[model samples]
Target: MKNLSLTPFFILLCLSFVKAQEVDISGKWTGNSYFLGTQIFTEYELHQEGNSVIGFGTTKNGSDSSKFRLVGEIKGQKIFLKGVEYVYKVGKGCLSKAEFTYSNSGSMATINGRWKGTMELTTCPPGVAGRVDLFHKKELMVAEPVAQSGTSPQMLQSIHKDDFEGTELVNALADRKYYALIIAVEDYNSPDIQDLDNPAHDAVSLSKTLNEHYTFEKENTLLLHNPNRSEIITAFDELASKVKERDNLLIFYAGHGIWDERLQQGFWLPSDATLDSKAQWLSNSTIRDYVGGIDSKHTLLITDACFSGSIFKERAVFNNSKAILEMYKLPSRRAMTSGALKTVPDKSVFIQYLNKNLARNTHPLLSAEQLFQSFKVAVINNSPNGQVPQYGPIGQVGDEGGDFIFLKRGSR
Candidate 1:
């Protein structure tokens, strides 16, 4: 040995070994998993002994359930699990053998991986194949592929102004599901009405924000651009069919709205609507009926079009903050409009202010009522045209004096 210094070499080897060692993944974790473009709420409870691990988990989608019985081994920072996911279909038990492999995300607290399975059920005819992208429950609960900004408690406090009260109750929105139908009709068949400048772009921007910040499911969000009357109705019907009582439904329309003085009602002009045919325009009452039929716990209609205030029957009275959990259980129907039965500028001051506030809102939970108040204030203060935003309950609809809850990501 020619003056071999063993210290540095020994430390390097030890560090390499430590780095390659498997992390301890033993705990309860809850997160969302995506399969076929739908978000599924998932939970895991695992117990590890030595390198071997055993666990059971449950996945929920509305009323449907998928239970898993798992056995796995942790090997060099990766976990390999083999399990049978028992799912109920047509009142019978259907089982699928699944394999999941999760690699440590440089932290023992979290892991993520892909899950694949094949089903050969007794009740069904052919075998089915399925694959899902899943992840360990992260402290910051936002959409994936986008890193969390990790706003601290101090930052949250600093951002919340005194005007918006009851922000401490924001965590109540965590368990609720958000569904949105965003419609923007910039192009129209009639040449006399003129084309819009920003509705389609605005709709897309809103949809992206909803997914990135609010955890809206990809499948549940309907982004309709320049859609005709039938298409609009079909979109609403589809959303109504899938929504559940634990969910919140948002219907946003950015287009031309006509106030029929003779009928004392408002109509949303679709892409195919012509000046000659009033029948082609979709009535607010018809839209209300479609929204009221949904099983969602809360429904909000946001319109940037002209005469948008015609959507609400009356102004909402109960704006105070109650127990958020109990508040979520109550039904609500609300609307926020750009202007009170007047023509708003096509540039969209309403959505601009609304987006800015919502993106910066630090409250753990923000109610629709609070959101509307902010919109009203901002639009009145900023807009040169003085387009007064309106907010209230949909008349004769299911307005139960309850407000819709919006969860701020990582608020908990």
Candidate 2:
């Protein structure tokens, strides 16, 4: 007996039968897919015109969820779809290539195929393949649109100004000042506390960028190099006292950080911190308390140290509305970190992209979320060890779904 289970000519055979039926693959498509022998749920809203097919989809594998933009072409009775971009992802996600064969039994229409992932797109999972079994949801009313607006809300969450709807939202911060507290701990007094090469230099670079390009003035931006635990708290206290309720505050930290798994806490090591004890280490909870004490309308915390992402707890991330100005209306406590609960490099690829984006940005009122998302993908792709950057609202820190807006010097 000869085994003809499947061959490379499968796609060719599907194409021959595809011409028998007219293809109109539009509207909702929901089904199951497999990768690494594990089953995953997928939902797509597709539109097909002529031979071109375009859509967006949400896929879930257990607790992990990701939204991807789809682009494909209809081949006779078959469709070849590829994930071009990841609009949103909860964890490590990569682009996918899928080929589906559409078949109708007069009562129901189903598409079956196989999907593969791009290993280089994201780390870990390497690359794998599995089967795709999808059924079209046939609820006809001429045009079956995904949303009231043609675009999905997933795309709207993107930080680009051009992607937003309506005019810019007005920010009444003309009388207010943008205060920045930059703390970079590079030189450690204790041998136990590892010294970093880039924090001090990074602090200077960021201060210059803020003063020259953004609304933050030189006098308003305070730089602290090799600050002890006391000095760090003193800096926050000063900001709390000096900053007005309408003012905005930006806190930037770059140095060695660690997560105390036993205590379920995270800390930033000051220059004087010792390995024997966490006495001189700055606790994230303490920082959160200090951040809450500040009356600033918006607070943006940028951390470029290891395990910096631990600042957020049950967080709500950036989701841009129709107008840009809506970002600054409510008081917010937002954090932008280099990577999630992982050790980052000393030289700092995160800060490099961050500064580059800030310098090149011409937008008069750029939100902190916009700045972070613009270079997030680049940081992930360019990082040597595939570090995943994080951005979200800090818990119990007076965050009201607003964001810190970076005003360009001459744009306004």
Candidate 3:
């Protein structure tokens, strides 16, 4: 036989091929599966070192974070990880195993697997607690498609008055069993009010429009106009008292919003509220406290006001961040404001663009994030002076996977 030497170049080529065939199942992944009668989606960030893997899982629920360890090997095209499960709120569960088939072709590798396990509850000690059976499967794919221009005009027309049909959005929301509250306030009581003649007329007209179009199946909506501070407080208190498990609560406020530095929070400037008297105004924290006190699974807070961003300040006395973050992490609560800190609220813009646009679109449901982006763009485009609204997750966006839309037009 002819003598042949294996050169370094050939050896390196073989090593490259082996590496290419190997799948690195590291980094962050979002998994969705139906478990225990609820659709549970979790975000897992994992790190693999040598033959051991460690990671944490954040579920759709607001449970405490969970830590997971995996010890397995890659055999041919299949990878296996087996170990005990330790969830934050739910403690050490039975031993679980994960099996995945990885296919490496080009830049991406597809991982398909199933995870079956029983979880324990750490919060409830001295008791084994109920067993949690879970199943997880994943598929690799390209990024989610972006909103396209093809859907933009259709969405825009949906929000305009010319094409708007009353109650279409409201009825659609009712079909989804969404309990929504719509509040419209037009205050003409200001000392510098130039529009004195149309105060009641404006309020009545807005109320009629909302009432004529929106319908609530759960009858959970509260519509108020020019309510005094005490009235607003009482209304909210009554609503807070009625919360139940798995309930969806929505608080919609449309009014003048002011930030009092002395109090260090925002306030919905009721018609009768005066800047001079601190006692007459309701603090933003007070509203948050009321909402937070409600033991509901989800809450949507929408405020349309100038300087509405002040409500989200980090140093407010009744810092809502804790509760907001908790509820959001549970993926149950969301909040949106019309303007940013120090930004002047454009009431006309909110109604004409934001609300109207939501009433028009029929496809590609808009999300809160998407709405914020579109609203910002629309405001800048329509305004004589370019203006942009400020928005961000009160907690983390990953927690709340669902999107919000006005039911009438299915536009978010």
- Taken over the whole model, the C-alpha lDDT of each candidate is 0.73, 0.80, 0.51
Candidate 3 deviant stretches above 4 angstroms? 1-177, 188-218, 314-329, 343-347, 395-412
Which structure among the candidates has the greatest TM-score? 1
lDDT-wise, the better of 2 and 3 is 2
Candidate scoring better on TM-score of 1 and 3: 1
Question: Which runs of model 1 end up more than 4 angstroms from their true locations?
Answer: 1-173, 315-326
Ordering by lDDT: 2, 1, 3
The digit string of per-residue lDDT tens for model 3 on 28-145 reads 5565534346545555445555545555444554452344434566665666665444423343233355666766556444555655543434122232222222222233343434
Q: State in Å the error of residue 270, model 2.
A: 0.6
Local lDDT at 316 for model 3:
26
TM-score of each: 0.60, 0.59, 0.49
Model 1: per-residue Cα lDDT over 136-219, one tens digit each: 553333332444588433344322322112332342245557889999999988887899999998898888777766657788
Backbone collision tally, model 2? 1
Comparing 1 and 2 on TM-score, the stronger one: 1
